[model samples]
Target: MRSGIVAIVGRPNVGKSSLLNALVGQKVSITAPKPQTTRHRIQGVLHGDNAQIVFVDTPGMHRAAKKALNKAMNDAASNSLHYVDLALFVIEAGRWTDEDEAVLERLKSVKSPVALVINKVDKFSDKNDLLPLMEKLAPLREWAFVMPLSALKGANVNVLAKQLMERMPEGPPLYPEGQVVGHDLSFTISEMVREKLMRSLAQELPYALTVETEAVEREGGLLKASAIIWVERDGQKKIVIGEDGAMLKRVGTAARRELEEMTGGKVFLKLWVRVKEGWTDDPKALSRFGYEGG
Candidate 1:
Protein backbone atom coordinates (compact mmCIF):
# COMPACT_ATOMS: atom_id res chain seq x y z
CA MET A 1 0.00 0.00 0.00
CA ARG A 2 1.04 3.60 -0.59
CA SER A 3 0.86 6.27 2.11
CA GLY A 4 2.11 9.82 2.50
CA ILE A 5 1.15 13.45 3.23
CA VAL A 6 0.10 15.92 0.52
CA ALA A 7 0.12 19.62 1.29
CA ILE A 8 -2.46 21.79 -0.52
CA VAL A 9 -0.88 25.22 -0.99
CA GLY A 10 -2.58 28.21 -2.58
CA ARG A 11 -3.67 31.81 -2.24
CA PRO A 12 -6.81 32.82 -0.38
CA ASN A 13 -10.19 31.54 -1.69
CA VAL A 14 -8.52 29.32 -4.27
CA GLY A 15 -10.51 26.35 -2.85
CA LYS A 16 -7.77 24.50 -0.94
CA SER A 17 -10.09 23.60 1.91
CA SER A 18 -12.83 22.67 -0.54
CA LEU A 19 -10.43 20.35 -2.31
CA LEU A 20 -9.51 18.68 0.97
CA ASN A 21 -13.17 18.09 1.82
CA ALA A 22 -13.81 16.67 -1.61
CA LEU A 23 -10.83 14.28 -1.43
CA VAL A 24 -11.72 13.09 2.05
CA GLY A 25 -15.44 12.88 1.21
CA GLN A 26 -16.25 14.82 4.40
CA LYS A 27 -15.81 18.24 5.95
CA VAL A 28 -12.58 18.14 7.96
CA SER A 29 -11.85 21.84 7.56
CA ILE A 30 -14.05 24.91 7.86
CA THR A 31 -14.49 26.86 4.63
CA ALA A 32 -15.86 30.37 4.05
CA PRO A 33 -15.83 32.95 1.30
CA LYS A 34 -13.57 35.23 3.30
CA PRO A 35 -9.85 35.03 2.81
CA GLN A 36 -7.77 33.46 5.59
CA THR A 37 -10.79 31.61 6.98
CA THR A 38 -8.44 28.77 7.89
CA ARG A 39 -5.97 29.66 10.66
CA HIS A 40 -4.33 26.31 11.35
CA ARG A 41 -2.86 23.30 9.55
CA ILE A 42 -5.77 20.86 9.37
CA GLN A 43 -5.04 17.23 8.44
CA GLY A 44 -7.71 15.18 6.72
CA VAL A 45 -7.00 11.48 6.14
CA LEU A 46 -8.48 9.72 3.10
CA HIS A 47 -8.56 5.93 3.34
CA GLY A 48 -8.55 4.15 0.02
CA ASP A 49 -8.63 0.44 -0.76
CA ASN A 50 -4.86 0.09 -0.98
CA ALA A 51 -3.57 3.50 0.01
CA GLN A 52 -4.19 6.35 2.45
CA ILE A 53 -3.56 10.00 1.68
CA VAL A 54 -3.26 12.51 4.50
CA PHE A 55 -4.04 16.00 3.22
CA VAL A 56 -2.77 19.02 5.12
CA ASP A 57 -5.10 22.00 4.61
CA THR A 58 -3.26 25.21 5.41
CA PRO A 59 -4.06 28.93 5.69
CA GLY A 60 -4.00 30.91 2.46
CA MET A 61 -0.54 32.24 1.67
CA HIS A 62 -0.70 36.01 1.26
CA ARG A 63 1.41 39.13 1.57
CA ALA A 64 1.97 39.44 5.28
CA ALA A 65 1.76 42.60 7.37
CA LYS A 66 3.88 43.35 10.45
CA LYS A 67 1.33 41.91 12.84
CA ALA A 68 2.48 38.81 14.72
CA LEU A 69 -0.69 36.90 13.85
CA ASN A 70 -0.33 37.58 10.15
CA LYS A 71 3.31 36.52 10.21
CA ALA A 72 2.40 33.35 12.05
CA MET A 73 -0.26 32.48 9.48
CA ASN A 74 2.16 32.92 6.58
CA ASP A 75 4.70 30.82 8.40
CA ALA A 76 2.13 28.08 8.90
CA ALA A 77 1.28 27.98 5.21
CA SER A 78 4.90 27.94 4.06
CA ASN A 79 6.00 25.41 6.65
CA SER A 80 3.40 22.91 5.47
CA LEU A 81 5.38 22.43 2.25
CA HIS A 82 8.34 20.87 4.06
CA TYR A 83 8.42 17.18 5.00
CA VAL A 84 5.65 16.19 2.59
CA ASP A 85 5.67 13.59 -0.14
CA LEU A 86 3.92 15.88 -2.62
CA ALA A 87 2.58 19.42 -2.85
CA LEU A 88 -0.56 20.40 -4.77
CA PHE A 89 -0.17 24.02 -5.80
CA VAL A 90 -3.78 25.06 -6.35
CA ILE A 91 -4.78 28.07 -8.43
CA GLU A 92 -8.12 29.47 -9.54
CA ALA A 93 -9.13 28.59 -13.09
CA GLY A 94 -8.87 31.19 -15.87
CA ARG A 95 -6.78 33.63 -13.82
CA TRP A 96 -3.46 34.19 -12.13
CA THR A 97 -2.45 36.84 -9.62
CA ASP A 98 0.63 38.09 -7.80
CA GLU A 99 -0.40 36.19 -4.69
CA ASP A 100 -0.50 33.00 -6.70
CA GLU A 101 3.02 33.71 -7.91
CA ALA A 102 4.12 34.29 -4.35
CA VAL A 103 2.76 30.88 -3.40
CA LEU A 104 4.61 29.35 -6.33
CA GLU A 105 7.87 31.01 -5.26
CA ARG A 106 7.48 29.61 -1.77
CA LEU A 107 6.98 26.12 -3.19
CA LYS A 108 10.35 26.42 -4.96
CA SER A 109 12.19 25.81 -1.69
CA VAL A 110 10.42 22.52 -1.05
CA LYS A 111 12.05 19.37 -2.43
CA SER A 112 8.80 17.48 -2.92
CA PRO A 113 7.19 17.14 -6.34
CA VAL A 114 4.66 19.93 -6.98
CA ALA A 115 1.42 19.29 -8.83
CA LEU A 116 -0.30 22.25 -10.45
CA VAL A 117 -3.96 22.00 -9.52
CA ILE A 118 -6.21 24.37 -11.45
CA ASN A 119 -9.33 24.42 -9.34
CA LYS A 120 -12.79 25.90 -10.02
CA VAL A 121 -12.83 24.71 -13.62
CA ASP A 122 -16.63 24.71 -13.56
CA LYS A 123 -16.53 28.51 -13.61
CA PHE A 124 -15.11 28.52 -17.13
CA SER A 125 -17.53 28.83 -20.06
CA ASP A 126 -15.50 27.26 -22.88
CA LYS A 127 -13.40 24.25 -21.90
CA ASN A 128 -10.78 25.19 -24.47
CA ASP A 129 -9.72 28.20 -22.40
CA LEU A 130 -7.95 25.81 -19.99
CA LEU A 131 -5.23 25.02 -22.51
CA PRO A 132 -4.02 28.60 -22.72
CA LEU A 133 -4.20 29.01 -18.96
CA MET A 134 -2.13 25.89 -18.49
CA GLU A 135 0.42 27.08 -21.03
CA LYS A 136 0.71 30.40 -19.20
CA LEU A 137 1.33 28.74 -15.84
CA ALA A 138 3.51 25.88 -17.04
CA PRO A 139 6.65 28.01 -17.45
CA LEU A 140 6.54 29.13 -13.80
CA ARG A 141 7.81 25.73 -12.65
CA GLU A 142 8.08 22.10 -13.67
CA TRP A 143 5.14 20.16 -12.25
CA ALA A 144 4.58 16.47 -11.66
CA PHE A 145 1.15 16.90 -13.23
CA VAL A 146 -1.11 19.72 -14.43
CA MET A 147 -4.73 18.97 -13.60
CA PRO A 148 -7.91 20.97 -14.12
CA LEU A 149 -10.64 20.14 -11.66
CA SER A 150 -13.50 21.70 -9.70
CA ALA A 151 -13.24 21.22 -5.96
CA LEU A 152 -16.78 22.47 -5.48
CA LYS A 153 -18.23 20.20 -8.20
CA GLY A 154 -15.82 17.25 -7.73
CA ALA A 155 -14.92 17.22 -11.41
CA ASN A 156 -11.69 15.33 -12.15
CA VAL A 157 -10.95 15.19 -8.43
CA ASN A 158 -11.00 11.41 -8.44
CA VAL A 159 -8.55 11.29 -11.30
CA LEU A 160 -6.25 13.64 -9.44
CA ALA A 161 -6.59 11.50 -6.32
CA LYS A 162 -5.58 8.36 -8.20
CA GLN A 163 -2.55 10.07 -9.70
CA LEU A 164 -1.50 11.37 -6.30
CA MET A 165 -1.82 7.89 -4.81
CA GLU A 166 0.32 6.43 -7.54
CA ARG A 167 3.05 8.95 -6.80
CA MET A 168 3.14 8.28 -3.05
CA PRO A 169 5.76 5.81 -1.76
CA GLU A 170 4.66 2.34 -0.76
CA GLY A 171 3.96 1.99 2.96
CA PRO A 172 1.35 0.88 5.43
CA PRO A 173 -1.60 3.07 6.33
CA LEU A 174 -0.77 5.82 8.80
CA TYR A 175 -4.18 6.19 10.41
CA PRO A 176 -7.01 3.81 11.28
CA GLU A 177 -9.79 3.17 8.80
CA GLY A 178 -12.48 5.12 10.66
CA GLN A 179 -10.37 8.13 11.61
CA VAL A 180 -10.74 11.14 9.31
CA VAL A 181 -8.85 14.00 11.02
CA GLY A 182 -5.80 14.62 13.22
CA HIS A 183 -7.41 17.03 15.67
CA ASP A 184 -9.24 16.01 18.83
CA LEU A 185 -12.87 16.42 19.83
CA SER A 186 -12.33 19.76 21.60
CA PHE A 187 -10.66 21.38 18.60
CA THR A 188 -13.41 20.18 16.27
CA ILE A 189 -16.07 21.46 18.64
CA SER A 190 -14.40 24.83 18.92
CA GLU A 191 -13.99 25.03 15.13
CA MET A 192 -17.68 24.20 14.70
CA VAL A 193 -18.61 27.13 16.96
CA ARG A 194 -16.23 29.44 15.10
CA GLU A 195 -17.70 28.37 11.75
CA LYS A 196 -21.22 29.14 12.88
CA LEU A 197 -20.10 32.54 14.13
CA MET A 198 -18.21 33.22 10.92
CA ARG A 199 -21.33 32.49 8.87
CA SER A 200 -23.68 34.54 11.08
CA LEU A 201 -21.65 37.65 11.89
CA ALA A 202 -20.75 40.55 9.61
CA GLN A 203 -17.55 40.61 7.58
CA GLU A 204 -15.52 42.46 10.22
CA LEU A 205 -16.72 40.37 13.12
CA PRO A 206 -15.62 37.04 11.71
CA TYR A 207 -11.92 37.93 11.90
CA ALA A 208 -12.27 39.45 15.35
CA LEU A 209 -13.89 36.35 16.84
CA THR A 210 -12.30 33.12 18.17
CA VAL A 211 -13.88 30.24 20.04
CA GLU A 212 -12.52 27.96 22.79
CA THR A 213 -14.19 24.83 24.08
CA GLU A 214 -13.73 25.29 27.79
CA ALA A 215 -15.28 22.10 29.01
CA VAL A 216 -16.81 18.95 27.61
CA GLU A 217 -18.43 16.33 29.76
CA ARG A 218 -20.54 13.25 29.32
CA GLU A 219 -23.91 13.36 31.07
CA GLY A 220 -25.83 10.12 30.64
CA GLY A 221 -27.09 10.05 27.03
CA LEU A 222 -25.97 13.61 26.26
CA LEU A 223 -22.69 15.53 25.84
CA LYS A 224 -22.27 18.81 27.71
CA ALA A 225 -20.02 21.43 26.13
CA SER A 226 -19.05 24.91 27.35
CA ALA A 227 -17.29 27.42 25.10
CA ILE A 228 -16.06 31.01 25.17
CA ILE A 229 -16.04 33.49 22.31
CA TRP A 230 -13.18 35.96 22.50
CA VAL A 231 -13.46 39.35 20.86
CA GLU A 232 -11.04 42.23 20.47
CA ARG A 233 -13.16 44.98 22.01
CA ASP A 234 -16.24 45.66 24.10
CA GLY A 235 -18.20 46.83 21.06
CA GLN A 236 -17.26 43.63 19.21
CA LYS A 237 -18.42 41.60 22.17
CA LYS A 238 -21.73 43.41 22.15
CA ILE A 239 -22.07 42.81 18.46
CA VAL A 240 -21.46 39.11 18.90
CA ILE A 241 -23.86 38.87 21.80
CA GLY A 242 -26.34 40.99 19.87
CA GLU A 243 -29.17 43.08 21.32
CA ASP A 244 -30.95 41.06 24.00
CA GLY A 245 -28.54 38.17 23.27
CA ALA A 246 -30.26 37.29 20.01
CA MET A 247 -27.10 36.65 17.95
CA LEU A 248 -25.33 34.50 20.50
CA LYS A 249 -28.45 32.41 20.90
CA ARG A 250 -28.63 31.91 17.17
CA VAL A 251 -24.96 30.86 16.93
CA GLY A 252 -25.35 28.47 19.84
CA THR A 253 -28.44 26.82 18.35
CA ALA A 254 -26.72 26.29 15.03
CA ALA A 255 -23.57 24.88 16.66
CA ARG A 256 -25.54 22.54 18.89
CA ARG A 257 -27.49 21.00 16.04
CA GLU A 258 -24.31 20.31 14.02
CA LEU A 259 -22.50 19.05 17.09
CA GLU A 260 -25.34 16.64 17.81
CA GLU A 261 -25.15 15.25 14.32
CA MET A 262 -21.36 14.99 14.44
CA THR A 263 -21.21 13.35 17.84
CA GLY A 264 -24.23 11.18 17.17
CA GLY A 265 -25.98 12.29 20.35
CA LYS A 266 -27.62 15.30 22.00
CA VAL A 267 -25.34 18.26 22.82
CA PHE A 268 -25.79 20.83 25.56
CA LEU A 269 -23.66 23.81 24.54
CA LYS A 270 -23.10 27.02 26.46
CA LEU A 271 -21.55 30.05 24.77
CA TRP A 272 -20.24 33.30 26.21
CA VAL A 273 -18.54 36.32 24.67
CA ARG A 274 -15.57 38.01 26.33
CA VAL A 275 -13.39 40.92 25.30
CA LYS A 276 -9.61 40.59 24.92
CA GLU A 277 -8.34 43.84 23.54
CA GLY A 278 -5.93 43.68 20.56
CA TRP A 279 -5.69 39.92 20.64
CA THR A 280 -4.85 39.60 16.97
CA ASP A 281 -1.76 41.80 17.09
CA ASP A 282 -0.46 40.64 20.43
CA PRO A 283 1.81 37.59 20.41
CA LYS A 284 0.60 36.24 23.74
CA ALA A 285 -3.02 36.72 22.81
CA LEU A 286 -2.46 35.10 19.43
CA SER A 287 -0.85 32.08 21.12
CA ARG A 288 -3.84 31.80 23.44
CA PHE A 289 -5.96 31.64 20.31
CA GLY A 290 -3.63 28.81 19.09
CA TYR A 291 -1.52 30.84 16.65
CA GLU A 292 2.04 29.67 17.17
CA GLY A 293 5.47 29.66 15.46
CA GLY A 294 5.93 33.30 14.63
Candidate 2:
Protein backbone atom coordinates (compact mmCIF):
# COMPACT_ATOMS: atom_id res chain seq x y z
CA MET A 1 0.00 0.00 0.00
CA ARG A 2 1.04 3.65 -0.54
CA SER A 3 0.42 6.42 1.93
CA GLY A 4 1.62 10.04 2.12
CA ILE A 5 0.79 13.59 3.12
CA VAL A 6 0.15 16.25 0.46
CA ALA A 7 0.05 19.86 1.54
CA ILE A 8 -2.17 22.12 -0.59
CA VAL A 9 -0.71 25.62 -0.51
CA GLY A 10 -1.98 28.71 -2.30
CA ARG A 11 -3.16 32.27 -1.95
CA PRO A 12 -6.61 33.11 -0.61
CA ASN A 13 -9.73 32.37 -2.72
CA VAL A 14 -7.83 29.99 -4.97
CA GLY A 15 -10.24 27.16 -3.97
CA LYS A 16 -7.76 25.09 -1.91
CA SER A 17 -10.45 24.01 0.52
CA SER A 18 -12.87 23.34 -2.34
CA LEU A 19 -10.31 21.06 -3.97
CA LEU A 20 -9.80 19.15 -0.71
CA ASN A 21 -13.53 18.56 -0.32
CA ALA A 22 -13.81 17.44 -3.93
CA LEU A 23 -10.91 15.02 -3.53
CA VAL A 24 -12.25 13.51 -0.30
CA GLY A 25 -15.81 13.42 -1.75
CA GLN A 26 -16.99 15.09 1.43
CA LYS A 27 -16.98 18.50 3.10
CA VAL A 28 -14.11 18.16 5.54
CA SER A 29 -13.20 21.84 5.32
CA ILE A 30 -15.35 24.98 5.13
CA THR A 31 -15.29 27.43 2.20
CA ALA A 32 -16.50 30.93 1.39
CA PRO A 33 -16.10 33.39 -1.47
CA LYS A 34 -14.18 35.69 0.83
CA PRO A 35 -10.43 35.53 1.30
CA GLN A 36 -9.06 33.98 4.49
CA THR A 37 -12.25 31.95 5.01
CA THR A 38 -9.94 29.09 5.97
CA ARG A 39 -7.89 29.88 9.06
CA HIS A 40 -6.69 26.44 10.10
CA ARG A 41 -4.73 23.49 8.72
CA ILE A 42 -7.40 20.89 7.96
CA GLN A 43 -6.56 17.37 6.81
CA GLY A 44 -8.88 15.50 4.42
CA VAL A 45 -8.01 11.89 3.77
CA LEU A 46 -8.72 9.98 0.55
CA HIS A 47 -8.69 6.20 0.86
CA GLY A 48 -8.12 4.12 -2.24
CA ASP A 49 -7.90 0.32 -2.58
CA ASN A 50 -4.14 0.30 -2.00
CA ALA A 51 -3.28 3.84 -0.97
CA GLN A 52 -4.27 6.64 1.38
CA ILE A 53 -3.60 10.31 0.62
CA VAL A 54 -3.79 12.81 3.46
CA PHE A 55 -4.31 16.24 1.94
CA VAL A 56 -3.53 19.13 4.24
CA ASP A 57 -5.70 22.13 3.38
CA THR A 58 -4.03 25.24 4.73
CA PRO A 59 -5.00 28.91 4.95
CA GLY A 60 -3.91 31.25 2.18
CA MET A 61 -0.37 32.51 2.58
CA HIS A 62 -0.19 36.27 2.05
CA ARG A 63 1.85 39.32 3.05
CA ALA A 64 0.93 42.07 5.47
CA ALA A 65 0.05 39.68 8.24
CA LYS A 66 -0.14 42.56 10.70
CA LYS A 67 -2.75 41.11 12.99
CA ALA A 68 -1.98 38.16 15.24
CA LEU A 69 -4.69 36.12 13.56
CA ASN A 70 -3.35 36.79 10.06
CA LYS A 71 0.21 35.97 11.14
CA ALA A 72 -0.96 32.72 12.64
CA MET A 73 -2.69 31.79 9.39
CA ASN A 74 0.42 32.54 7.38
CA ASP A 75 2.49 30.55 9.83
CA ALA A 76 0.11 27.63 9.58
CA ALA A 77 0.36 27.62 5.81
CA SER A 78 4.14 27.83 5.82
CA ASN A 79 4.53 25.25 8.57
CA SER A 80 2.46 22.68 6.72
CA LEU A 81 5.26 22.27 4.20
CA HIS A 82 7.53 20.64 6.76
CA TYR A 83 8.00 16.85 6.47
CA VAL A 84 5.29 16.60 3.82
CA ASP A 85 5.58 13.82 1.27
CA LEU A 86 4.45 16.14 -1.54
CA ALA A 87 3.31 19.72 -1.92
CA LEU A 88 0.55 20.83 -4.28
CA PHE A 89 1.15 24.48 -5.08
CA VAL A 90 -2.31 25.48 -6.32
CA ILE A 91 -2.97 28.65 -8.29
CA GLU A 92 -5.75 30.14 -10.41
CA ALA A 93 -5.87 29.36 -14.13
CA GLY A 94 -4.80 32.76 -15.53
CA ARG A 95 -3.99 34.99 -12.59
CA TRP A 96 -0.65 35.13 -10.80
CA THR A 97 -0.55 37.75 -8.12
CA ASP A 98 2.20 38.97 -5.81
CA GLU A 99 0.96 36.64 -3.09
CA ASP A 100 1.26 33.67 -5.44
CA GLU A 101 4.82 34.68 -6.17
CA ALA A 102 5.41 34.98 -2.44
CA VAL A 103 4.17 31.46 -1.90
CA LEU A 104 6.38 30.24 -4.73
CA GLU A 105 9.43 31.84 -3.16
CA ARG A 106 8.63 30.12 0.12
CA LEU A 107 8.26 26.76 -1.62
CA LYS A 108 11.82 26.98 -2.94
CA SER A 109 13.21 26.09 0.48
CA VAL A 110 11.10 22.97 1.00
CA LYS A 111 12.69 19.57 0.25
CA SER A 112 9.45 17.84 -0.85
CA PRO A 113 8.53 17.53 -4.50
CA VAL A 114 6.16 20.39 -5.38
CA ALA A 115 3.48 19.90 -8.03
CA LEU A 116 1.94 22.88 -9.76
CA VAL A 117 -1.85 22.58 -9.63
CA ILE A 118 -3.53 25.15 -11.89
CA ASN A 119 -7.04 25.28 -10.47
CA LYS A 120 -10.26 26.90 -11.85
CA VAL A 121 -9.53 26.07 -15.48
CA ASP A 122 -13.27 26.12 -16.21
CA LYS A 123 -13.17 29.90 -16.13
CA PHE A 124 -11.56 29.88 -19.56
CA SER A 125 -13.43 29.17 -22.80
CA ASP A 126 -10.51 27.75 -24.70
CA LYS A 127 -7.95 25.36 -23.21
CA ASN A 128 -5.23 26.95 -25.33
CA ASP A 129 -5.71 30.18 -23.43
CA LEU A 130 -3.94 28.55 -20.47
CA LEU A 131 -0.74 28.01 -22.44
CA PRO A 132 0.71 31.40 -21.65
CA LEU A 133 0.22 31.04 -17.89
CA MET A 134 1.52 27.50 -17.98
CA GLU A 135 4.58 28.51 -19.97
CA LYS A 136 5.27 31.37 -17.60
CA LEU A 137 5.21 29.11 -14.54
CA ALA A 138 6.98 26.15 -16.11
CA PRO A 139 10.48 27.56 -15.78
CA LEU A 140 9.97 28.57 -12.17
CA ARG A 141 10.96 25.18 -10.76
CA GLU A 142 11.41 21.51 -11.56
CA TRP A 143 7.85 20.68 -10.62
CA ALA A 144 7.04 17.06 -9.79
CA PHE A 145 3.86 17.26 -11.87
CA VAL A 146 1.80 20.01 -13.44
CA MET A 147 -1.96 19.76 -13.76
CA PRO A 148 -4.73 22.13 -14.83
CA LEU A 149 -8.13 21.34 -13.37
CA SER A 150 -11.25 22.92 -11.98
CA ALA A 151 -11.71 22.22 -8.30
CA LEU A 152 -15.29 23.50 -8.15
CA LYS A 153 -16.63 21.68 -11.23
CA GLY A 154 -14.53 18.53 -10.69
CA ALA A 155 -13.19 18.83 -14.21
CA ASN A 156 -9.95 16.86 -14.57
CA VAL A 157 -10.07 16.18 -10.82
CA ASN A 158 -9.85 12.42 -11.24
CA VAL A 159 -6.69 12.77 -13.27
CA LEU A 160 -5.18 14.95 -10.59
CA ALA A 161 -6.11 12.38 -7.92
CA LYS A 162 -4.60 9.50 -9.93
CA GLN A 163 -1.38 11.42 -10.42
CA LEU A 164 -1.13 12.21 -6.69
CA MET A 165 -1.84 8.62 -5.73
CA GLU A 166 1.03 7.38 -7.85
CA ARG A 167 3.48 9.75 -6.16
CA MET A 168 2.75 8.60 -2.60
CA PRO A 169 5.38 6.45 -0.90
CA GLU A 170 4.62 2.78 -0.30
CA GLY A 171 3.25 2.22 3.20
CA PRO A 172 0.13 1.35 5.16
CA PRO A 173 -2.91 3.60 5.36
CA LEU A 174 -2.33 6.66 7.55
CA TYR A 175 -5.94 6.82 8.71
CA PRO A 176 -8.61 4.18 9.24
CA GLU A 177 -10.90 3.17 6.42
CA GLY A 178 -14.01 5.32 5.76
CA GLN A 179 -12.61 8.21 7.76
CA VAL A 180 -12.18 11.55 5.97
CA VAL A 181 -11.46 14.45 8.31
CA GLY A 182 -8.79 14.49 11.02
CA HIS A 183 -10.63 17.03 13.17
CA ASP A 184 -13.32 16.30 15.75
CA LEU A 185 -17.05 16.97 15.43
CA SER A 186 -16.73 20.17 17.45
CA PHE A 187 -14.19 21.59 15.02
CA THR A 188 -16.43 20.68 12.13
CA ILE A 189 -19.42 22.32 13.77
CA SER A 190 -17.47 25.49 14.53
CA GLU A 191 -16.09 25.69 11.00
CA MET A 192 -19.54 25.15 9.47
CA VAL A 193 -21.02 27.91 11.65
CA ARG A 194 -18.12 30.21 10.77
CA GLU A 195 -18.57 29.43 7.08
CA LYS A 196 -22.21 30.46 7.30
CA LEU A 197 -21.22 33.65 9.05
CA MET A 198 -18.50 34.29 6.46
CA ARG A 199 -20.98 33.86 3.61
CA SER A 200 -23.85 35.73 5.27
CA LEU A 201 -22.24 38.67 7.03
CA ALA A 202 -20.56 41.76 5.62
CA GLN A 203 -16.99 41.20 4.53
CA GLU A 204 -15.41 43.19 7.34
CA LEU A 205 -17.79 41.87 9.95
CA PRO A 206 -17.06 38.26 9.15
CA TYR A 207 -13.33 38.86 9.73
CA ALA A 208 -14.14 40.46 13.06
CA LEU A 209 -16.00 37.45 14.39
CA THR A 210 -15.48 33.71 15.01
CA VAL A 211 -17.55 30.73 16.10
CA GLU A 212 -16.76 28.48 19.07
CA THR A 213 -18.68 25.31 19.90
CA GLU A 214 -19.31 25.32 23.64
CA ALA A 215 -21.21 22.08 24.16
CA VAL A 216 -22.25 19.06 22.17
CA GLU A 217 -24.40 16.11 23.19
CA ARG A 218 -26.42 13.42 21.52
CA GLU A 219 -29.92 12.53 22.69
CA GLY A 220 -32.65 10.45 21.05
CA GLY A 221 -31.04 10.46 17.64
CA LEU A 222 -30.49 14.21 17.78
CA LEU A 223 -27.15 16.05 17.99
CA LYS A 224 -27.50 19.12 20.16
CA ALA A 225 -24.78 21.79 19.91
CA SER A 226 -24.33 25.17 21.57
CA ALA A 227 -21.95 27.76 20.12
CA ILE A 228 -20.95 31.37 20.66
CA ILE A 229 -20.32 33.92 17.93
CA TRP A 230 -17.65 36.19 19.34
CA VAL A 231 -17.34 39.66 17.86
CA GLU A 232 -15.16 42.70 18.63
CA ARG A 233 -17.70 45.27 19.65
CA ASP A 234 -21.29 45.87 20.71
CA GLY A 235 -22.22 47.30 17.32
CA GLN A 236 -20.84 44.26 15.58
CA LYS A 237 -22.75 42.06 17.98
CA LYS A 238 -25.98 43.94 17.25
CA ILE A 239 -25.38 43.63 13.53
CA VAL A 240 -24.76 39.89 13.81
CA ILE A 241 -27.96 39.55 15.81
CA GLY A 242 -29.61 41.75 13.16
CA GLU A 243 -32.97 43.49 13.31
CA ASP A 244 -35.24 41.20 15.37
CA GLY A 245 -32.42 38.60 15.27
CA ALA A 246 -32.90 37.90 11.56
CA MET A 247 -29.22 37.63 10.64
CA LEU A 248 -28.30 35.28 13.46
CA LYS A 249 -31.33 33.15 12.67
CA ARG A 250 -30.31 32.85 9.06
CA VAL A 251 -26.74 31.84 9.93
CA GLY A 252 -27.92 29.30 12.48
CA THR A 253 -30.45 27.74 10.12
CA ALA A 254 -27.95 27.42 7.32
CA ALA A 255 -25.30 25.93 9.62
CA ARG A 256 -27.75 23.47 11.13
CA ARG A 257 -28.92 22.26 7.76
CA GLU A 258 -25.38 21.69 6.53
CA LEU A 259 -24.41 19.99 9.80
CA GLU A 260 -27.37 17.62 9.60
CA GLU A 261 -26.46 16.74 6.04
CA MET A 262 -22.80 16.23 6.92
CA THR A 263 -23.39 14.16 10.08
CA GLY A 264 -26.38 12.28 8.68
CA GLY A 265 -28.36 13.17 11.80
CA LYS A 266 -30.71 15.85 13.07
CA VAL A 267 -28.88 18.84 14.61
CA PHE A 268 -30.19 21.11 17.33
CA LEU A 269 -27.96 24.22 17.09
CA LYS A 270 -27.92 27.17 19.47
CA LEU A 271 -25.94 30.33 18.69
CA TRP A 272 -25.18 33.38 20.83
CA VAL A 273 -23.41 36.57 19.73
CA ARG A 274 -21.15 38.23 22.27
CA VAL A 275 -18.43 40.90 22.25
CA LYS A 276 -14.82 40.03 22.96
CA GLU A 277 -13.23 43.41 22.23
CA GLY A 278 -10.59 43.11 19.53
CA TRP A 279 -10.15 39.40 19.68
CA THR A 280 -8.46 39.29 16.32
CA ASP A 281 -5.39 41.14 17.55
CA ASP A 282 -5.28 39.52 20.95
CA PRO A 283 -3.08 36.44 21.22
CA LYS A 284 -5.01 34.98 24.14
CA ALA A 285 -8.29 35.44 22.33
CA LEU A 286 -6.85 33.97 19.14
CA SER A 287 -5.71 30.89 21.08
CA ARG A 288 -9.07 30.63 22.74
CA PHE A 289 -10.74 30.70 19.33
CA GLY A 290 -8.51 27.77 18.15
CA TYR A 291 -6.13 29.64 15.87
CA GLU A 292 -2.96 27.55 16.00
CA GLY A 293 0.49 29.19 16.16
CA GLY A 294 -1.21 32.26 17.65
CA lDDT scores, all candidates in order: 0.90, 0.94
Model 2 residue 133 lDDT score:
96
For model 1, residues 1-294, the per-residue Cα lDDT tens digits are 999999999998899999999999988998888888888899999888889999999989989656777788888988898899999999999889999988888888889999999999999989998888899888888899999999999999999999998888999998998899889888888999898888888777888878888999999989998999999999999889999999999999998998888888999999988988888888888887788573
User: What range of 10 consecutive residues in model 1 has the weakest lDDT sum?
Assistant: 285-294
lDDT of 2 by residue, 149-182 (tens): 9989999898989998998999989899998989
- Pairs in steric clash, model 2: none
Q: Please list the residue runs of candidate 2 whose C-alpha ends up more than 4 Å from where it truly belongs after superposition.
A: none
Off by over 4 Å in 1: none
State TM-scores per candidate.
0.96, 0.99
Q: What is the TM-score of candidate 1?
A: 0.96
